[model samples]
Target: MQALAGFLWWAAVFLSPVVREATLGNLDPVAVAVFDIPLFVVASAVAAFGVKAAALVSAGWTGAVAVALAIYATVTTEAGWGVLGMGAATAGSLIALCLVLLGRVPTAWIIRGPFAFRPAIPRPTAASHVASTFGQIVLFWGFFLAAIPFAVAFLEGRWAVVLLFPSFAAPVGVAVLILASALGISAAVAMSTLGNGTPLPSAMPNHLVIAGPYRWIRNPMAAAGILQGAAVGVILQSWLVVAYAVVGSLVWNYVVRPLEEADLEERFGEEFRQYRDAVRCWVPRGSKTLRSQKP
Candidate 1:
């Protein structure tokens, strides 16, 4: 919810005529996108922090932003695309807040509802986890990066969605690439450095990791790839990628988690369950009083 809100808010900023005239006046957006790619990475951290803290301050800030936008819209009275886009964002944010408060988020299935981290090593777990981590990387990225060429080819051949490239598609796709890379790498680093394990159950960590990005969310690495896939779908405006994300999320929730948690229970016994029950899997319960295990 917070991720979407932040993205939409920034989208409004990018699409606003003032910004477009200031930065893109008679200039190609591709050049700007190249320079602005770093901003996309920063934006991911911003979103992570926002989501981690949203439940605390979202309602107040969102209401304030809405009123500010409403006054601006009233003053301008032109009802331009910018105002409309901003309204949509404000509306979405409010709705998301309400749902979050009610604990009825439409996306609950995609997030904290059915996830857990488990460390179980019946055998040569470390190598197995390392291999699994690498395999997951290949599996997710192979399909994710493949979308660019496929989108280019399919759209170019079918309907000639050429106009979508620089102005809309490229920036978003590039943003996803950067965000995904940062998140995925962070996840791996946290696991290897903090947990003394790889991402795979085969080489399950000797210690539970609640450090680095795991300090905020349980399935940071998994969520990174999944969210990246969804970002691609949004950028390309393709239901195929969106469908992949949805199906993948469901798979993670229903199929993958159960097996992983069972493995965890077998390996860690009551310890795994206690952590799972105490901490949320994806949507960041926020502000653990105790410090994480020191490296």
Candidate 2:
């Protein structure tokens, strides 16, 4: 159910100003942006309180928002109502299907965020860990980043012109992208080889990875990602990309990290807590080295 909400929210964001423009031609993008990922994020936050009534209210609001969008479409555009109806139906179906699937799965196996215990599931094999990390990378780099240029074009009602790569100050952008890629990839590799797992919570680093770039900062991968995003923003000459990176980082700091720390404490116990005490989540502390264990 949560995944469905997330997907619907994402789909709304992906379609974005195109949907806005086509449906409500002169509507402010800012208003629509409010209902974008931020809305779903807020809903998720409310749901996280573990109050069923509150969660249900949030879900109800989400549905109401969908219907309001449908009505807005009906009033404004010729074909928008049809498009909105289809989108609503699709979102509803996906939510229903997910609820059914979740019903069959143990609550223990259901993933909530960056960190959580999964008692019903077996620990990942080394290969599975590597694969999951690579998959996430592909989604982050290949899919999300690749989709942005096209998404922007769609927002501008220029679907005939789909651009997949960043292009403004190409030379500098390429250098920056390459450097960030090196950093992120190296960090991921260290997580796999030293930690014996992936950066993802699902295939979490089994060992406290204090090697390689991790020796520099606790979250080299996230830093690299943000840097890469900044590079892309520079390359494309788009503040939007830069803003996305900033928001992503903020979400990690405020939302993802604390939960992740809690889960690490639950899993690795005092070992992780001690590591957290020693290392900064973003900034690297004063440099010091010790012989590392490869567990």
| Maximum-lDDT candidate | 2
lDDT value, candidate 1, whole model: 0.57
Off by over 4 Å in 2: 1-128, 153-170, 287-295
Lowest lDDT sum, 10 consecutive residues, model 2, at: 153-162
TM-score of each: 0.47, 0.56
For model 2, name the residue pairs that clash: none
Model 1 clash pairs are: 125-202, 125-203, 126-203, 129-203
- What C-alpha lDDT, on a 0 to 100 scale, does residue 98 get in candidate 1? 52
- For model 2 the local lDDT of residue 249 reads 84
- In terms of TM-score, which candidate is strongest? 2
Candidate 2 positional error at 272, Å: 2.2
Query: Which residue runs of candidate 1 sit more than 4 Å off their true CA positions?
Result: 1-140, 144-170
